[model samples]
Target: MPRFPRLTAAATAALALGLLAAAPATSDEPLVTEARVSAHFDLAAGQTPENIALDGDGSADLTFALARQVAHVTADGATSIRATLPAVAHPATPIVTSAAVTGIARAHDGTLYVNYATGTSATGVWRLPPDGGAPEQIAALPADGLPNGLALDEARGMLYVADSVRGTVWRVPRAGGTAAVWATGAALAPLPAPPAYGFGANGIKLRRDAVWVSNTDRGTLLRIPVLQDGSAGPAETRANGLDGVDDFAFPGHGRSVLAALNSGSRVVLVRADGTVTTVLTEADGLSHPTAVAVRGRTVYVPSAALSTQRDPNLVLARLRHFISRG
Candidate 1:
């Protein structure tokens, strides 16, 4: 599971109060509507979906964090295990308790790439072939760091990995080779040790000639330009005040984004102007929502239920007033 900061008694109480005090939708037409649980996962079986990758057929591929399995869910909500990573004997991971799969990206040819944090030399990016055979490690990342979010640039044949523990973004070739540090700065660094388990860069995506990242500890969304020479330019803060922001997806053609606030147990819409609108909350069956994926008019949210420990499931919502770019 993705590491989270240990909340103090007062902080926990404040979160509860904040959730209770959240204002209801005042807009005549809400951005998200008709939210409902599409599939309920078995928490006892460690089937918590951490991140999501959508297929063209309205299906989704998810990384079952603690289960170390990649699962496929049909449009009708039926689930099947696609691939499972090998179990680690003993892990020396920091903050996070066990070894598991965190992020996943599906290539155009049906190839699946996932990040596995085993706290050993085996920790790195692994690739599952389209033919459904065994998976193999494609790139080697830091053994001590937690690789949380992954994004594939199919056109460029590159993969960007977000390391939550190390506070860095790594670049790896799609053909499989050594990983290189693409970007690192204070914006990506975790907060000092007071709260503990403060994850830095949690979620990542490549969009519009730039790489976007979410800082879970700092609660900020950042954008780094992809320079002309294939190098990273200056990092800019695109949005802030988003506590517990995890994986996000850009819906439609414009700059509007749908982000998951894991600790807040909410999914919000961050507009192009930087204003945030709380679109979905706990009442929408969000139990520690970990990621957001938009396919056509449907928005998919996978709740890890790490804190709630209730229903770890997939919630589907309709995107109102959305116009597809394609």
Candidate 2:
């Protein structure tokens, strides 16, 4: 098991204090982009990138939301196919019988974890080996539930999954076992009425001893503590008012996070104390930015461009200049 290093207690406290003393974010004083590091590179026409996971060597593994394929993008902007899913069925009852792979997580040893559902069968969590072999089913969820986000607590040998339809966060062992509901609160539930996005907990990440999740339709961020007994504590709000919070990334070792404002078509910096900073907006060239992956100084953003497919591409930004060590 492997764990991402976290900010020291003192450093995290300092960031919270800094955010408390800073002024609120506004359009007129937005956080500007430091630099664009990667050249825009579009995928094959008709393909849309969904989730992203760092491959430990500065490269990233990407999932296609429409195509049945997974791809790898290098630091220089080159892309290559890694895996593809077989044709799946559709049940007559549900409007949607199948969903493309929408979430991906890479283990310390390079294995990839993907989330997808096919018709009325139980949703399968497939594991892809690093050496390029057929994917194997490691875990399964209810046929009606939709798993949207995945987070690996490598140090604890646990995999945390966000079930968008069920409005629950499930905890499953990495080595395969029964998955149980680990955390659930009002924040994880979907909007009360129809015409809603039908999304609840959309993004999940494990940092230190806490597991964080985002509510897409509600635009809220919540987290729960992982107790010594390997059980989850109560969920608490970390931030709110994000119009379309999606997948996010924690850069370096700080408490601040970069979250993709999907419907807002922007990426915003969320400080420790809930202060928000508009990092990149539509004016800076973004179209439905869906997921963010941070590794060292580079922040990788995969824009779905569902409406503006003509310019669909991945954007990498240099961030050392804008991020504060505290």
Top-lDDT structure, candidate number:
1
Q: Tens-digit lDDT track for model 2 on 1-326?
A: 00001236643222111112233335465344454535354534435677889887898888775565688988887888898865555531122233556688999899998876554453657788999998777888777776778898888888899877678898878887677889877779877535565678888898789988888878888878899998888888889998778889886465678898876678988888999878887766676777888776677888766544435567887663344432
TM-scores of all candidate predictions against the true structure? 0.92, 0.84
- Which parts of model 1 have CA positions greater than 4 angstroms off? 1-26, 323-326
Native-to-model Cα distance after best TM-score fit, residue 193 in candidate 2, in Å: 4.6
Cα RMSD, each candidate: 6.1, 10.2
- Misplaced by over 4 Å in model 2 are 1-46, 91-97, 307-310, 322-326
Name the 10 consecutive residues with the lowest summed lDDT in model 1.
13-22
Q: Tens digit of lDDT per residue, candidate 1, span 249-316?
A: 98766666899998779999887778998999999999999999998779999998877768999999
Task: Name every residue pair that clashes in candidate 2.
Answer: none
Scored by CA lDDT, what does every candidate get?
Answer: 0.86, 0.72
